[model samples]
Target: MRAPTTPLRPQPDSLWRAIAAPMSTGAPLARDIDVEVAIIGAGYSGLSAAYALQKRGVECTVLDANPIGWGASGRNGGVVSSKFRLSFPTIASTHGIDVAKRMHRLAHDGVRTVEAFVDEFKLERARFEHTGSLRCAHTERALASICAEADWVRTTLNDTSMSVQSRAEVEHETGSKGFVGGVLSADAGTILPLEYVRGIAAGLNARGVPIYEATPVIDMSREQDGRVLLTAPGGTVRAKQVIVATNAYSNLTEATASYHRELVPFRSAMIATAPLSPELDAQLMVNRRSYTETRRMMKWFRNVDGRMLFGGRDAFGKEGEPTGFDALQRAMVALFPQLKDVPVEFRWSGYVGMTFNALPHVGRSDDATTFCLGYNGAGVAMASLIGQHAAALALGEKPELALLAQDGLRPVPFHALRAPGVRLVAAWYQFLDAVGA
Candidate 1:
């Protein structure tokens, strides 16, 4: 109904931007062009799809409202977890064990996909690390579930790399007594997410895929010959196929209005501490592993380049409000009492797409348009894998993974009231988590 404004720019002091390598610039779309595929959004999903398409000798062009990786792809916590937003048992119960197993395997492969990309492209700046991840139990009741899930993963999935830690073990490994216990997954790890996405963009650029920055697709129309005509600010693209990969930052164009309504975007905020002293680092994060608590409204943190970067829910606070940051700081101090006096160097926020079913989707929105989005905060690994799948679908090939084919996008009920509804849901979850209900 209204023109889409330019996406917000990344904060100048964001840790990712501060450490990011200089990026090459791409000119905006200057004139009309024709291609086999046109990809909107240059984040991980779109860039990954473009890369995959190029590998298959397909012609595709990528367009972004902002520079590549300007969204959650760059501002995220960098936890390369090979898991869905929903729990494994929940997925199994809902989708059957066979489908659940397939989904698990797909997630595992998603992690490997990132590993392969880093290695094949020699993304030295990505600073990819295989340090593993910990899912800490915030309460004693959560510890039981954590242990049970770890056992299920080991026995059912035959994943020997995952194990449940006892309370003492968790405290010893994390140097924090706040966690009752945890599940350690050695296959999971972390990476410089921004660097990884930028690396993919660079690789795609090298392969001759024109990436148009500051080029927002304003509208899309179907041509008589079944092509999709995408109109941007500077020019137009007539493509045989279109892939909508905008995710949380999706604009409400006529082409994407219905699908965009299916996604509920909530702000996820983070704070990075000034470099911790080596002794403090050792005292706090003994294993330097990425970690997230087992709470519905969760907190995630990791030791990144000698600093502690942490994030959590921001549903209760607006963009400029300090409520979210204050809560995060308190949580950080509660976990590591020694960090109560630590200085926070950076604070920022980004939108994460939440789906009604709490699972990411990838499929055809229409005969000529395909999409991959709604990661529900687990975008790092899932987005990359889904992007590749979207590329396959674009080329008229079946996706190798069946996870994307399940639970296609459905608009949330009372979509117009989503903001207040999400805030209420967040408050309820917080209360439940607080009371260990």
Candidate 2:
């Protein structure tokens, strides 16, 4: 790993950035250019799309307002769990059993996609750990849900890689006794998020796919010649097709205003404690399994390189600064009293794009514009898969998982009031969680 250098715009002072390996922040587009496909955003989705396009021998370039890994891709918790925000049984009941099974397969394929990238690109510093993840229940209702999920995974999905645990088993697995019960999925894992994304950017550059940093697409319009014209601050991009992969930052440009309306952006925060002693580390996170809560207002933690990383919601402070360090520390201490004195060394937050369906979307705005976004806090795997599907859609090819492909997305209702609405929903969820609802 290498020390992070400064970028054009100030980015979150995240622990991932601090320890990420170095990669070039390619120069901004400074002149008119034409390409087969143009991508906006330098995060996982954009870079992955560029890679797919490049592999297919298609001409493409990536544009971002900031440097590579400047968004949620670099800042998010690197849990590579093969599951969505909604459970499989719920999807099975809502959608048909076939569609639910396909969705489940897609989720597993997403994990493989990321693993393949790491292995194919030799991203050793990304530290891809296949230690698996644990989903702990905060309430008995949550425990019941976990049990249902486990049963569904085994019976319906015909997979026995997961096991349900009792409260004593949960306490044994995680050093904390806060959880009632839990389920462990052996397919889940962890990585250094910034390192992984930066490694992807490196691989893309090696493939000759130009990634222009600090180049924002201000406006987009269609040309009479049936091509798409993108107006960037430094130059213009004329492309046969365009891919908008900006996700939560879609609101930054007028070109993606409609895409922004399809998602409710929420700030997610995380804190990291200084490295723990070998004894304490072993005692806290036995087997080094990634841990998460089943509460609506979710919480997650894991030991990364001897440091304890705890995360939850509402981390943004005034003036773009990160808040809730104290609250996060208190929560962490509450979970594991042994960490009461473990000083927090880092605090940061990033925005996640939430869809009304609580699932990702891959679709086209027009015949010439393709987009894939709204990972609902599971972007590490889902974003990569969606990006690949977005590329296939742009190429006029059917995506393997056809359920995700759509003509367009419906806008979130009352989009302007989402901020306050999110606060209210979060408060209600917290209240219900307190009462074990």
Predictions in order: lDDT: 0.83, 0.86
Candidate 2: list runs displaced more than 4 Å. 1-7, 316-319
TM-score of 2: 0.96
* Model 1 alpha-carbon drift over 4 Å, by segment: 1-12, 252-255, 315-323, 406-409
lDDT of 1: 0.83
- Residue 274 Cα positional deviation in candidate 1, in Å, after optimal superposition: 0.7
lDDT of each residue in 1-437, candidate 2, tens digit only: 22223237756787887887655557888888999999999999999899889989999999998988888998998999898888888888988788888998998888898899999899899988888889999888888978888998799989887898899988988899899999999888998999998899998888889998888888899999999999877788999999999999898778788899989888888999999988888887787888999878888999888899999875544325646667778888988999988889988888899988888888998899998989999999888878988998999998875356566878999999988888888888878877888
Candidate 1's TM-score reads 0.95
Give lDDT tens digits, candidate 1, residues 1-437: 22334553543357888889887667778788999999998988998899889998999999887778887898898899888887678788888888888888888888898898898888889888888899999888888887888788788878787888888988888778898889898988889888999898888787788998877788899999999999987788999999999887774355566666778888888899999998988776678788999888889999887899989975365655666888888888988887888899998878898887778888887778888888999888889888999989878888766556733556677888877988989989988987888
Residue 134 C-alpha lDDT in model 1: 92
By how many angstroms RMSD does model 1 differ from the true structure?
2.6
The true-versus-predicted C-alpha distance at residue 102 of model 1, in Å, is: 0.5
What is the RMSD of candidate 2? 3.4
